[model samples]
Target: MTKADLIESVYLKTGFSKKESAEIVELVFDLIKTTLEKGEKIKIAGFGNFVVKEKDSRRGRNPQTGDEIEISSRRILTFKPSQVLKGAINDSNA
Candidate 1:
């Protein structure tokens, strides 16, 4: 589902207007992004962990021209779902 869908769900569950729901969802996303930008991790109970991982520069090959290239170092955000979330996803009722 998209962000709009998520905002709608929040609106339905909390009896908030569409605009307020969108703001709430946006605020949550902004908080997550800001936290990740600070090189920190967020762990939500029964949901998952959001981690920022760092990778060193590396050599990579171009698939088309077969030329070697230098891949720049970067930080990546990753998520690992909690066991409960995984179970919920695999549940038949879902």
Candidate 2:
């Protein structure tokens, strides 16, 4: 869902004003962004883990021109869902 949708959901659940809901949603997202920017991990029980990993530079081929190129290493964010979340999703699909 989009940010607006999330804000709406929070407002409905918390009985907060629209402005307050938006602020709450924005605050949560800002916290996540800042934590990730610091190369830290966030773990939410029964939800998932957010981690930042570093990768080494490597050689890669240019798919369009078939030219060899160097790829610079960078930090990447990854998410691993909790077992409980996985089970819930799988159960719903089944």
Candidate 3:
């Protein structure tokens, strides 16, 4: 779902004002962003883990020109869902 959808859900569940729900959603996102920027990981029980991983510069080929290019080093964010979450998803599908 989109951010607006999430905000609405929170507002409905908590009986918070629209403005308050928006702020709450935005604050949660901002916290996640800031934590990732610090190269830290967040683990939410029965949900998932958010981690930042660093990759070294590497050589890559350009698909268009078939030229070798240097790929700059970068930090990437990854999410790994917890076993409980996985089970819930699988059960729903089944």
Candidate 4:
């Protein structure tokens, strides 16, 4: 869901003011971003792990022009869902 939807849901569930809920959501996201910037990982029990991964520079083809190009390496954020979360999703789908 979108950020607004998440904020609304949190507000409803916790009986918090809209502004308060929004701040909380923003803070959580900011914390995650700051932590990731430090090249660290975040793990939420029964949810998932957030990590930053390094990518090596590589050659790539331009789709439109079919020209060779050099792709610069960069760090990317990734998430791997925890086993508990996977099981929960599987059970729900079942």
Give the whole-model CA lDDT for all candidates, comma-separated: 0.97, 0.98, 0.98, 0.97
- Stretches > 4 Å off in candidate 3: none
Ranking by TM-score: 2, 3, 1, 4
Measured against the true structure, the TM-scores of the candidates, in listed sequence, are 0.93, 0.97, 0.96, 0.92
lDDT, candidate 3, 25-90, per-residue tens: 999999999999999999999999999999999999999999999999999999999999999999
TM-score of 2: 0.97
| Cα distance off (Å), candidate 3, residue 52 | 0.4
lDDT of 1 by residue, 1-94 (tens): 9999999999999999999999999999999999999999999999999999999999999999999999999998899999999999899576
Compute the lDDT of residue 38 as modeled in candidate 4: 99
Quick one: how many clashes does candidate 4 have? 0
List the candidate 2 regions with Cα displacement exceeding 4 Å: none
Q: What is the alpha-carbon lDDT for the whole of candidate 2? A: 0.98
Q: What is the Cα-based lDDT of residue 86 in candidate 1?
A: 90
Of the candidates shown, which would achieve the greatest TM-score relative to the real structure?
2
Model 3, total clashes: 0
Q: Is candidate 1 or candidate 2 better by TM-score?
A: 2
